[model samples]
Target chain A: MDIKLQKVTKIFQAKDKSETVAVNALDVVIPSGKLIGLLGPSGCGKSTTLYMIAGLLEPNEGRIFFGDEDVTDLPPEERGIGLVFQNYALYPHMTVRQNIMFPLENIKVPKQEALSRAQEMADLVGIGELMDRKPKQLSGGQQQRVAIARALVKQPRVLLLDEPLSNLDARLRLQTREEIKRIQRETGITTVFVTHDQEEAMSISDQIVLMDFGVKQQVGEPQFVYDKPINLFVAKFLGTPPINLFAGEIVKNKLLLADGKKYRTETQAPEHQEDLTEDAIRAMTHEVKVPICNVEIMDKKAPDGDVVIGIRPEGFVVDEKGPLELEIFMVETIGRDTSLVVKDPFDDNKSYRIIIDSSYRVKAGDKVKFSFKPDKMFVFDKTSGDVL
Target chain B: MLEKQSNVKAWLYLAPAMLLLSVFTFYPLFNAFFLAFLRDYEFLLGSARGFTFLGNFINVINKPDFGIAMKNTAVITFVSVPIAVIVALMISVALNSIKKFQGFLQTVFFLPYVTNAIAIGMAFAFIFHSDYGLLNTMLGWVGIDPINWINLRQAGNADTSWIRAMFALLVYTIWGGLAFKIMVFLSGLQSIDKQYYDAARIDATPKRRVFSKITVPLLSPMIAYITITSFIGAFKAYRTIIGMFGESLRPPGALSKDSLITIVGLVYDSLAHADATGAISEAAAASIILFLIILAFTLIQMQVSKRRVHF
Candidate 1:
């Protein structure tokens, strides 16, 4: 089923009499027959948004539509939505067969038909042999499969999963994630999946809506969103080990580091040239030529502004002659890649992380020179945190 | 050396409790069984009296009131237990659906279970009185004449009979008996994972189907527990009845005594007037019979319930 949320907001009355906006003015369109992921940090509104769509929660101000019908005020049952909780929420007292058949029996399907359908769902989820066993009698993965089968038996128009694989072990998470993707593809049902894990969301979703602090940061296809994040939060949140940022100032129409390094901008100069007269521009330009000046204009080759520059861990390259010197503080070798925690002599409050091939011999207290590709450098406005 | 010391320490830790159990529980149990064959003074004075095999047992079986008391106990157990279990289950299901003030309602239902039985019996006596009672007053408003209820023996002599009205007192007893059972079933209902209901709703399952297919089957274990406990409790339903009808209704008498006399009341009558030795022995025999009946019912219920329990 297609889902549409218009001006959705959720405000929770906290214990201390404060209102916490869990979702704020969110508008989203989820097309039918596709898997969509709501991804964000722990306190973000991803799960809240999914719950609103599932009819498990009512948005404070919004209208929800499933297909052509407005179902905002409908109960969960009336909405015809299947929801799987994070804990799997299987009834421990019922056998797997009974659990799967519960929805059919509730709908008053004939006993024989309910049995056959239950068996079909069981086999589909690959837990047919365990049908007679209760939830506790099965492994976590098997119980998860039974929960999925129970949700599917109703043949609901929309399926909602809230961090369905978060309870599983690492290996099982990957396996189950793959199974979820395959099942979603096979069934071709509209599904909204919620998770704080970006990789899990990116791997399975046709479209990913990334959120932060109850606000929609960005929404796009997984690859497009990853490659071209619209803002600093999106850029930093989507990557592992996060992106590194540096403070630079605008000087002489060029970017300047605090440590007397100058960088040039490839983009057009600011349109506020009228604010800076010709004489002021000339004076600013002449200051770059003076070597003894205390002002450190960023290198003419770098992007220019008083901006925070974001560099991915993989963006840095090891160069013996590079100008940037980082004191390696720690190194974590993980077979294929090594994560290095290095101190930035230029900034006391922050550290820069760089990733290198694991084969490279690197250790703590070692000094390393690094350079990043020009295009890989992302500059953001310091105050707005918007990409500049 | 440390392992041996720990083992010794474990035994030392358990010694006090073990000693208490032996002194209070196990020793008394063995003494009761042994004394079952001896004269009363042998038990009281710890004398070495010769065993009178089946002597007391044979005398107890020959008592005329034994048959009537046994029948009364059976009737109470069979009728009261099933009714209490069914009523408790229904109340539990209703309480489960009430989202608001559920705890308050549960506490109200559970209050009677914790209240003293004598107090409930006193309260019930007033309400079930033949005249100037709440029930009779309500019946009067419905154009029914006031009739003798507690004094059913007198009622039978008059133009009207009130045996059925007297039996209505069982409903009060059942109400007080079912409070704890309802709490147990309520907990069982709450323990059910809500996902089952959600799944049922998605399938458009009707309310009745959901109750039968999911709620009833899932609550079988709790229902079984309630059944066994209620059955045991019903056989011991003497205090309330006596408190309501008073001692006159169960006068000191032989086996051809009043129809309302129960096994415990008979034992009380015999001990108060007849030979105390014979009365104690007869009480023991009656207790044994009651125990066996409860044990049989419990065993049967367990067998049937075990088949239905999902776990």
Candidate 2:
């Protein structure tokens, strides 16, 4: 089933009569049979969005639909959704087989048939031999598999997983995530996975929806969203060692770095430029106040205004005679790549990091002149955090 | 060599508790067993009489009220304890589900547990009175005749009427037993993860099925605990019965033998009535028998729990 949300909102009321908007007017379209990741940090409403889709939580406003069927008021079971909780909530008293067969019990399936189906599910999850073992007797990963088998035995139209790999050890998390992806593919259920781990989401999900503070930030193909983020938050959230941020401004159609140097310019539209209007762009650009930290001036000429520069770690190209100069503060060789921890020579506390080839023998105090790939640079209106 | 020294240190730490148990518990327990095998109480007077083996046991068994007391105790324990556990389980499950005023309701349910059992038993006695009691009045509202309860004790009545008096006692016993068990089961239910019920709800399991399959099995350990404790408690029922029925069966103004009695009551009666030479032996034998019965029941329950308890 294709899951669609039309301005769904959920407000949680507190004991003192205050209210928290857990999911604020969220809207998304989860294509049928595709694993869509709801990625965000803690308290970002990703889990709330997933739960609303699963019908475990009702939206305070707006409508939810599964393939054009209005299901805003439907309960979880009636919505044909299988949800695996964060802790993999298996019934501790039951054997693996019994846990898998639990959903079948109330449906009047023949006892033998239900048992056989449960066995099949266990085998599918590769725990067939452990059918008689209680949940407490199983290892964490094994118990996780049992929980998945139990959720899937009913053949739900949509599968909702709320941080399913959060409870596993690092090695098991990777293995079980692959297992989950494989199972979802075999079943071809419309799956909505929620997690704070951007790497996991990018690796496993076909589509990733990044959210923050109860608002949707970006939604697109994982690589597409990563390569061309719509906002500052998306850029900051999607990378390992994180995208390096520095304060800068456009001046006289030239990019100005914080150390008082004006790099050459070539005017270019941001990746999300088509969706923005001239007035909206002006309003976004007019809001930023500049020159807060070290700035890498892109070749792209933007209107003269305060902006935030986001550069992916790999965006740096080390050159002995490049235009921009950065004094190397430290060198960290992390197996595959060496990270050049550089700081503004004028302001020592304003440090900027860039990754280069580990084979490059760079040392601290070396002043390296560098230039950036124009496409790798993300220009954002500082105040509104919108890509410029 | 160091492990041996640590072991001795651990034993030293345990010395006070072990000594206390040996003096107060183990000594009395072994003495009871030895006394059960003897019929002479001359030791109480600094005189010696050899063991009479089964004589004391036979003497106590032959007393006419012995059979009545045993029957009464068996009936009350078997009937009231199970009913108490079931009622408490249901109430606790219901209490566990609701959030509105849950603490208030729990406090209300737990009130009787903290209150004196004898006081509640007396209140229940008034409620179950024959002519003008609260129970008969309620039954009378439904057109049932008022019962002969306390009157049956003062003046011997037909066998059927005596059963009514016993029924009155059962009602009080079960009511008094409910509060503590309910508190225990409620806490157990509260400690269970809410996620399991959410999972069951998504599975669309029916209410009754959820209760039997999820709630009951998950609660098996607590259930076993409540059941064994309740059975043993019922077996040792003393103050509640005495409070519900007056001191000597008949009230202060009446003229008859006590109609309602239990094993403890019979043991007390024998201790009070026995000639000086035999009193201690007879009382010890009766108590030893009661202890053995309780131990046997507890062992049987433990065996059942081994197979069924989930945790």
Candidate 3:
């Protein structure tokens, strides 16, 4: 079922009577039968949001709905949600079969039927033959599957996973995450996955909700949000080796990079240009001394002031005649892609990571000219961290 | 080579404790076993009139009060242990769940453990003292006549008086037993992972089902431990009774014999009259019987609780 949160907020009162907001007035529609990832750094309220959805936590204000039903006051047992905690939370004393059948015992399902349903869930999670084994007797990955099987045995409408694979080793984490995805797909449960790992969220989720502090930042398809970030924070959070940032300015109608004591105009748009065609900007510019990105990607009428420029590591292409020049601080080559640790001469000698093809034979201290891929570059208002 | 060196060093570290145990604990234990078989033994005179298997046991068991002591000990053990275990389990569970005043309440329940058992028994004796006692005064307020709880020793209403005396002893013993059992149970409850309850709650389990299926099973090991220990403790109860009924080991006034005397009481009474032929041997024999009884019951308890315990 589609889960809906309308201005849900949760505030925790510590022992000393100090109140801290864990989740703010957040709004999101988790589409039915699709996996949604609540992605953020630690203490960013993603897990809090999942817990509220699972009915394990009550929002101090606002309502939660499962499909059409307002379940704000309902207890967790009535919510029909399968929540798997980060630790797996398997009953240590019970065998896999007993743990799975335990939930059915609450609803008074016939003993024979409960046992069969438990077996079915165990089979679905691929722990069928291991039902007789206790939780500790199984490996971490197997135990994780058992937790999932037990959660599924109740046939809950929504599946909530709180960093479910964090307990497993690296290899097992990969394998178990695939198992979770497969199980969720086969069952078609509306699963809400919470994780601090951006790659883990982006790799599996149909839609990813990025959050910071207690507020929602952006929510979209993983790649769409990565490629077309709405703001500076989104641009930096959703990349590996992180997005490269440099301080620059938009002087008059021209976006210029501070090249030491001179303003090197990358591209120029008409004062009120709505559609900034790259050809039009190039035609109006003086003789092209260096290769640079088209300024058309910037929002129209972007105010002329200091701005933060964010570029993905993959956004750079080494060209001898490129507009931006940087000294290579270090060269780190790992087979397919070589990451050049470069120092931007324009932005206070800040270090930046730009992934280039390993085929380049550049070494440290060599100055390399680089050009930007238009879509991969973003301009943001410096103080407010908003996209310009 | 490294392991051998560590092994010798470990033995050296354990030497003082081992020496103490051999002198005080192990020597007495073996000596008792040897004396129980002797026809007549006297530790003071260092004499034994040769060995005769079961002679001392048979002579001791033939005494009329020996059966009574056995009956009294059995009554106390069987009645007090299960009641104390259940009550302490409930109290500890309550103590574990409450958010506020937990430490204060735990200290209150645990007060009896720190106080000497005999002191608590004396206090209970005064409460059950028939006239001008706290119990009788409360009973008076409830429109009941003062009952002879521990004062029937000088009287002739034998069966009723004995039952009342037994009741008083059970009450005193149960109160003294609560503190340790509650402390053990409270610690056990604390160590249990709380997530299990959360899982049960999400399953929409009823409170009763949660207690029976989740809470109790998880506490089964502790319950078993408390059960076996309380049983042994209740079996070896003598000092508390002395505090209540005094050196006579009976109720007040009309005592023709030491009523409510436990097996340990019988053993001590026999040892006091060590001048009698075979009396010291019989005391050793009585203790051996008590040991056998405890061992047998413990083994049975271990077997019964074995299947249920999670660990």
Candidate 4:
């Protein structure tokens, strides 16, 4: 089912007559049969949004629709949603088979049919051999599979998972997530998965909704949001070895990097840097006396003012003749790539990172010159964090 | 050597609790078990004639008062404990469902637990007092004649008086002891994760079905605990009746020791008449019998719980 929340808000009233707005005027449409990820930090209202959709919590302000049918006033049972909690929440007293069959029994399915359907769900989750075991006797991963089978046995229209993989060990987290994706596909149930792990969300979700402090920050394909974030928060939140930020400004038609060097915006076409001459590239290896050029185009949309520069670690190329220089402080090699932790040459108070192919023989104490890919760089207005 | 030293340190740390338990709990238990087999107990000399295997048990078993006490105790246990458990469980479920003034309701229900049992029994006796009592007065308002609740001697026959006294005692016992059971069940119900109920609600399970299938089974451990303790507690019912009626037991002119005497009351009566030849022996035997009955019920409950309890 396609779930829609229109101007929804939830407020929690505390004992002292104070009120907290947990979710504020949130609106989103989750299309049917697609796995959407609600990604955020701990207090970001992602789980709150999922619970509202499940009808566990009634919105204080607006209506909720499940495939064009208003279900705001309905209870959870009438909404036909299946929710798996962070702890799995299996009935400890019931065996795997009984736990899976409980919902069927609730709806008064015949005894024999309920048993067979429960067995079928167990087999689907690959726990057919462990149906007789209670939840306490099973490993964390097995327990998770039982929880999933229990939620899916009734074939709910929308499946909700709240940090389902948070309780598993590292290896099991990976394995169970893959299993969840497969099960969701096989069942073709619309799923809303809430998690704080960006990698987990990015790996499994068809669409990722990033939120912070009860507000939706960005929503798009995981890679698209990563590559082109709407704001500085989105840019900083979605990547590993997170995008490096620096205080920057535009003055006299020159982009002034935090490191004091100034580059004329019209010196070279940013699109043609890959084909630069070898000597030109090698010339970038020289000292502070030589200045670098043709790095990237300053976003024309940005008003002339103070801005924040965002450079992904991968955007930096180790060209000896490139425009920017840094004093390498440390080198870390991890198989395919090497990380160069360097002192910012122009700004004494800051440091930057450049991840180069492991084949590069850079060492600490070496002064390296570099430049960024034009496509990989972003500029945000200092006050508003809007990408320019 | 380190393990030996640590073991010695552990024992040294445990010395006070062990001393207290041995002096207060274990010694009395063993002494009672030994005294239960004595033939003639002389309280003046603080000695017994000889160890007579099951002699005291046989003597106490043959006494008419002992029989009446055993029957009365059984009646109270079998009647009041179940009523208390069912009523308290229902109250706990109702209290747990409402959020407004929940703390106030809990405090009101739990007031009886901390209040003196004897005080509450005295208050209950006034309410059930027969003439001008609150209960009889309210019934009189509805055109019903005042009923004799306590001291039912005016009812005329032995069987009718016994039945009336039993009914009056049961009402007080069930009412006086409900608070503790309600508190236990309420805490048990609260400890259960709200997620399961949320899951049950999503499954569209009916309220009665949820109670039977989820709440009951999930709370079976607490239920078993409450059952065994309530039965044992009811078996030891001495104070409530003493508070309601009196130590003399029968009213101004009673015929025999037939009114409302519990096992503990019988034991107390025997100990009070300690100058009699076999009085101490009979008291010890009665104590032993009460212990055995409680043990038997506890064991039966544990067996049932092992089969049905979830955790």
Best by DockQ: 4
Reference-based lDDT, residue A257, model 1: 41
Q: How does residue A290 of candidate 1 score in lDDT?
A: 17
Clashing pairs in 2: A266-A299, A266-A301, A267-A301
Better of 1 and 3 by lDDT: 3
RMSD of 4: 8.8
What CA root-mean-square deviation does each model show from the true structure?
8.1, 7.3, 8.7, 8.8
Lowest-sum lDDT 10-residue window in model 3 chain A: A288-297
| Best by the lDDT measure | 3
lDDT of 1 by residue, A1-388 (tens): 6898888999999769999999999988998999999999999988889878877788999899998899999988788877888888787777899888877776678999999999998888889899899899888888889888888887989988989889999999999999888888888889899999999999989999999999989988998887777788998998777888766665555654432233433433445678998876655553112111233323544344456667789888887876566778989998889999976554455677889878789899997777676656676777788876
RMSD of 1: 8.1
lDDT of 4 by residue, A1-388 (tens): 7988888898878989898787888888888899999999998888988899888888789889999899999889888888898888888888898899999999999999999999999999999999999999999999989988888999889999999899999999999999999999999999999999999999999999999888888888999999999999989888888888866776655565565464333333234558888676665544332223324334345457787888999988888776667678999899889988876654567677779999889889987888778778888888999898
Residue A224 CA error for candidate 4 (Å)? 0.9
TM-score to native of every candidate shown: 0.85, 0.91, 0.91, 0.91
Give me the runs in candidate 4 sitting further than 4 Å from their true place. A260-301, A343-351, B152-160, B251-257
Residues B26-86 of candidate 3: C-alpha lDDT, one tens digit per residue:
9989988988899877667878889999999999899888988998999999999999899
Runs of candidate 1 exceeding 4 Å displacement: A14-17, A257-306, A320-323, A333-335, A344-350, A357-363, B1-24, B39-53, B152-162, B248-258, B273-277
What would the per-residue lDDT of candidate 3 be over residues A142-183, giving only the tens digit for each residue?
988888888888899989898987888999878877887888
Model 3 clashing residue pairs (backbone): B153-B254, B154-B252, B154-B253, B154-B254
